[model samples]
Target chain A: MRPAEADGGARPVKEVRAFIASRGRAPASLLDRYVAGFGLVMGAAVVGRPIASLLGGLAGATDPSRAGAGTALVLLACAGYLALARAAGPVSVSGGDASWLLLSPLDRRGVLARPARLLLAVAVAAGLLLGLGLAAVLGAPDHLVWRLLAALVVGVSATLGGMALAVLAQASASWQSWVTAGVAVLVVLALVAASGQARPALSAAAHAPPAVLGAAAGAAALACGLLVRRALAALGRIPARALLAASTRAGHVATAAVRLDPGALTWIAEDNHWRARRLRSRRWPSLPGPLALAWQDWLRLARRPGRLALVAGAAALPAVLAQAGAVSATAALGMVGVLAGALAAASSGTAGARRDGDNPSLARLTGVGRGPALAARALLPALLAAAWAAAAFAGLALTGTLPATSWLWGPAVAPALAAGALRMARRGPVDHSMPIIDTPGGAIPTGPLFWALTGLDVALIGCLPAVAALLGGRMGDGSLMAAQALAGVAVLAAYVLRARRAR
Target chain B: MYESIITVTGLTVELGGNPVLTGTRLAVAAGEIVAVVGPNGSGKSTLLRCLAGLQPAGEGTIEVFGAAPSDEGPFWRRVALLADEPAWYPGLTAREHLELMSAVHTGPSRLTVEDALDVFDLRSRADAPPLNLSTGQRQRLALAATLLRPSDLLLLDEPERGLDAAFRERLAGLLDAYAAEGGTVVMATHDPLLAAHGRQVSPATGGVPA
Candidate 1:
């Protein structure tokens, strides 16, 4: 607790409490809370009974394969959580709080304590949920209540430990470096599990003796408390400017996530790229400015080898699924089309979005109009998506999964979709909601029309050829090709027209 | 009228392992306008942040209104700060943001949302989203929101940034007027017109020169 004299006996923390208390409880017009509560109750009732029955049925049915699968799944989820925590540490504050309250003469820990505790509680709840699910799946529901409690303790331990590492990374470069190393170790463990070399070890840990597990849980809780205390102490010493920067970056990540902007991830990676030396003197060939701009965009993607790997991996998913008989070749190709469409949506907006988001003034210095500049910017992403689509098509063809003629869809729709997405992204990241339409129960959100337009492009590019072939067969293949080509050309024309109008 | 409201001694601060303000010292009195002038990368903004208790001192101390600023201290309730760069929540409308500032302020504020909007010449764009506003409008909105509430100490870091010459003059007058009302004003700027409104303090080698 902060001393009263910290604020010259005025007790700023107490004032904050008073401010909150003065607002009273929920407002009279907060019907949304009831609506949300009703939804939650309905969701639980809908989902709970069946899940309970399934767990009851699976109890005491200890199949080694199921246990192995459950262990692998839990480990993968933990890895994902750890990686995410490493990338974007624990704390989140609005820009308003950073500017106003962060500089205020209030106990920093007192202000941060509630939010931090809430976040930690959420993490513990999530862990409990995951652990219970895993325990049920692994056939440890004999003494179900006790088993669940044990699992909860372990889950809380793991979550807090991960959080502690993440927060420690903020103050220590060495801890930050350990994050990548931890990821590498997780990858290795996953590889070992896949090879069946680590299944016994995982299964043993899953079914450890109750006494041993309890002791481990106690030790973990103690460690977690110490880590939380250390992190809060370290946080007090951290520069406010650093917190502000972190808050801004977190805001960008949140925005990118909400918008489902794939390019945003690339933007984050680009922003955080660690270079040995600043590329101050690096120069490109003095070709025409448009070409130079296009080259720069391409070079950015090229330098980030990880992004290229992701593109190739995404492009290969459909073919792999087809090869494994997970879906039909036509369905596989359509799935690939969806992936390509999403990639187009993400990569297409890269250059223009970066310009608009970070440096609009730099964009203005080009001396060119929006149309030409955007058109030039569109080229690199389009070509890249086309290459990815082509690679996917080749993989499908090589594996004898699809006819050679189906390859035509890749070259045509990929670039067209890319161009369309580029135009949509160049409109800027402003939220433009359409009017709400009246429904029987209430008004339904019309949502962002930009996303609807992007979805239309996806349907045109990803589903058009697939739907045409399903109805037409080999006899109608030529006609379907012509239709796809024409549709692609139309989309391209619309993109060009929009670009011209943008200026 | 001139009562020392802020005092700093041997204030050293580091950012990203590099010392920005080494052994800096300063004093500012009530009803005074002090311009912190320095070239880019100089510790002008840093000194102001230290005074406002935004940045932690690596060594030495800072006193605001005869007491050090901390999260549990009333010292912040008497201070208002405006940073050069705008930091706005994307979901908020300009009007809603002003309303939020008014609501969150610990002390009494004479300015309403309408007053702030009209004063900042943003009445027409009050309902518009922040992302819709231009760079200059965003800067003005930040300033308006910060200045909405009355405060004893006003810290403005490069307030002239992103503003036109006309707005710059208006800002100078605003600072002078605030000073005349017995408020302390410390602004970081390179604009000579704005600097001329206050006693110039060059912050070249970490500490401000007398």
Candidate 2:
């Protein structure tokens, strides 16, 4: 055997074997990470559980068992969703040392068994912890041991089943539709029914007697095991070359003709992807700069859905709490909408910039004929802020809270946010090694993207005084307000464009 | 004398038709670690980026490793860059950084980022987040990760900015050793002592080729 062939030097192999091997030697590192994860989970549970409990109390502190089942379903559903998302259509066994092991002395199925085998450790630990928690909660320490242990197994199985089904279901277009349909059904049930009434449909067994709960958990776990096997089976069928090629996001887009001026920040943003594409110059940062990146960022931000929903609630909360039924709901919501827009814009500005590392060098490698990428960086947030603020305003306007005379100021607030955000958008402290998080479940890109969005929110807040004056009809009416907003956005967009070009 | 691995002809960089670099030209061959030195805003990094096919020349031609600096030259795969504080996912560990890179690489082999870390002396705190590490540690980690990949043309922007003396010496030796293996390197630096390792080309305007 060649020495070079056997020696993997300088850089560790990114293969599953190498990754797993690193875990063993770096005992402290992995353990520390797990500890951190544990701390995070516990901390979140501690802080979050009480708030959830309080909210449930407001609806009626009805049933702890029901609440537990509901919480489990929600948590497990999110995990399932992530598993499906990661599967990306599930043609093969992805994780563990399958590829390298298959090539080694091990049999195919045996090689694939490592990731599958790790489930026991997971089940044992999770079961013990959960069992302890459940026993403590119910004051049933005598049955706690068996109950929690069984619950852990059941939980794992349920998640695994959901994950497997999600992976397979994702192959069909209707799966997303089905999930959407189910979520809609759940949401409706939540809004209309009493607390936890919808939970039983999904996790009823956990709410039943001790024996029933244990059995339910075990059965759920068994289903999850089946899912793991199905995923494994589906995985073994994929072509190796196809997997390898797909794994590396390498392709040259010959038709990807994007031109931007030299030495511009637009050029910088485009150039980053150029670095990302090691072997293919055919693909690069689109000539339009960060515009494409911005839209994508926007789409992902929208997917959270929580952002918009929160704004709606913020606006709605004010009106709902209002004593005047005539003025109760929508009116207060509008004022809050205006205020919330300001808050959102302020916070979102610094998203992608995260100090300053998102600066010149990080972006200096893409196409640079048109400043579209930079334009997108500036515009998408502005548009998104505008859309969001507008939605907030729409809610308020519907509620009869927004002064009709001043309503024109809503869109104008967007430009104000973008302008202020761009000024603050200048890079801060620099980080040398932040890899882009491609998936939402992966670490979110927390720099200029967030900052940009927040900046837009700031503009919304900044424009409020003017919005009030215009809406009140004391200053200018709709036309004057609209013109002012347009001018402001134009000015902000221009400043952002100019600054990026200089960069 | 060495055969030229890089050459630039009539290169000019412009913004909105205003010249940042007008009629810029340079050339260097194999087994050379040429330092493109200049004061701030002298277009030193721009020239390297153009040569690396990172930034397009407004008016010029470039070649690397006998091939023009096209975006996807074999030279690129064989090249690496130590950018000035590049972006990173704050959540990723150093090992994850190399893992991700190796995952996307095109080769029949493995790349171990650990040795590069060892060379930079970052093995102990490898799993530590770069954001929490000292500036020097982060820089070394970035440089180590880049060096982990095989490259012949290396375009570094102040690659030794935050390093201590030992790491600096190690870097110069690493460059020297690579040149010993017929690799060509172009770097931008502010240190005159380290600049002595290579023939110093003033990256600023108003300098004629030696």
lDDT of 2 by residue, B79-118 (tens): 6766677665323455544544443344521236556667
Docking class of 2: incorrect
TM-score of 1: 0.55
Return the TM-score for each candidate structure. Answer: 0.55, 0.39
- Once fitted onto the true fold, the runs of candidate 2 whose alpha carbons sit more than 4 angstroms away are A1-105, A108-158, A166-225, A232-381, A392-412, A417-429, A432-502, B1-210
What lDDT does candidate 1 reach at residue A259? 77
Give the alpha carbon lDDT tens digit for every residue of A1-503 in model 1: 45765454346766775786687676556678777776788789988997688557645645554455445556656767778776665665665566666788766666565557866886786677666655664556356655666667777777777777777776566677766776667656654553456667756755677786678778878887887778777766556665676777777777777775544655555445522212221234445444544444554555556756756656655554444343455463455454454455346335543544343322322223455555666666666656676666666665576677556656556546666556455544435365777764456645554544653564356446645664344412776667766676666656656655542
- Clash list (residue pairs), candidate 1: A7-B73, A105-B70, A105-B71, A105-B73, A106-B70, A106-B71, A106-B72, A107-B71, A107-B72
Worst 10 residues of 1 chain B by lDDT: B84-93
Where is model 2 chain A poorest over a 10-residue stretch in terms of lDDT? A252-261
